[model samples]
Target chain A: AQSVAQPEDQVNVAEGNPLTVKCTYSVSGNPYLFWYVQYPNRGLQFLLKYITGDNLVKGSYGFEAEFNKSQTSFHLKKPSALVSDSALYFCAVRDMAGTGRRALTFGSGTRLQVQP
Target chain B: GAGVSQTPSNKVTEKGKYVELRCDPISGHTALYWYRQSLGQGPEFLIYFQGTGAADDSGLPNDRFFAVRPEGSVSTLKIQRTERGDSAVYLCASSPDPAPNEQFFGPGTRLTVL
Candidate 1:
């Protein structure tokens, strides 16, 4: 079964400091990973996805994630954290080799808190 | 241009009652999905629809949960004999055809079973 694990329940960072929200995935075949953000009382908004490409993939709102094949990790990162960037982050994985199932398996989620 | 939209943003019902949640996918999106998200948990897939047909329904918890997309645009999820455990936020998402695309999500409908 394809699954994602977000080890940290919460991550705290100061504004202008680099932030990292960790994510690890387990899948049978190639993994299609995605990062989504959700604000309070709002739906999820897509940040980026790592289908197959370079290890580093940049996404919206100055966010990026590095796909480490050996580590089986895809950690979301930001060069400089902003207070407004604080939100709930979710890591999801999909097994490309799976049959007819396109739904993504999501992680428990990590709460990012950027202090001003 | 509008994103996916769901009706009855908040619904409070008594246990054993029937409730229907509606979802209107993005214009021209061919794939629609229904997911249930409990408090402090990620959304869990319930069903998937390609056009007017249900391509996958394995994630549905029980037979009491039913969904239909009669016109391939708007979908409805009907829960019969709702239990207290059924209280959660029901989310609907949509994506373009051809599979493996970023799904656009709606501001889920919060169902509260008393």
Candidate 2:
């Protein structure tokens, strides 16, 4: 089974400071990891994904995530946080070696709170 | 081009009522998906359709939940009997292919079962 875990239910960071939202995964084979952000009453917006590429993957809205295979983690990061950056973050994983199933298994989600 | 769009941005219904949610995938998109998201939780996969066929419906919780993508374009999700547990944001997403690609999501229909 492919699954993702967001250890933190909520993360708070000051504006202009770097912020990190942690995510870990477990899959039977090579994993396709993704990050998505959802704002109030809106659908989830894709941030970035790591299928088979460099360790660090940059995404929308000045956000990025590091795919650390050894640590089984894909933590979302931002160089500088802004108040508008606050939203619900989700980490998802798909098993590349699975039975051709492309449905993503998502984590519980982490709320990112960027304080001004 | 416009992204995936779902109808009835919000729906409120009493228990035991039958409801239908519609989704219009991006033009030419071959794949469509349905998911349910509860309060404080991430979206949970419900079903996936490839073309006009249901490629994968294993994620559906029970027989009460059903979906269809006729003509390989627009899709509809039907719930037989509404329950309080079914209250959540029903999301619809679409991808260009069946491969493991990034999916574009719609604003979602907020279903409130009263």
Provide the TM-score of chain A alone for each candidate, in the order shown. 0.97, 0.97
Chain B TM-score for all candidates, comma-separated: 0.98, 0.98
After superposing candidate 2 on the true structure, give the runs of residues whose Cα lies further than 4 Å from its correct spot.
A98-100
Estimate the TM-score for candidate 1.
0.98
Instruction: List where candidate 1 sits over 4 angstroms from the true fold.
Output: A98-100
TM-score of chain A of 2: 0.97
**For model 2 chain A, where is the 10-residue window of minimal lDDT?**
A95-104
> Any idea what lDDT model 2 has?
0.94
DockQ score of each predicted structure, in the order shown: 0.80, 0.86
- Listed in order, each prediction's TM-score against the native is 0.98, 0.98
- For candidate 1, lDDT tens digit of each residue in B70-104? 99999999999999999999999999984678999
Best by lDDT: 1
- Per residue, candidate 2 scores C-alpha lDDT tens digits across A1-116 of 77889999999999999999999999998999999999998898999999897999999999999999999999999999999999999999988995845888899999999988
lDDT for each residue of candidate 1 in A1-116, tens digit (9 for 90 to 100):
78899999999999999999999999999889999999999999999999887999999999999999999999999999999999999999888885736888889899999999
TM-score of chain A of 1: 0.97
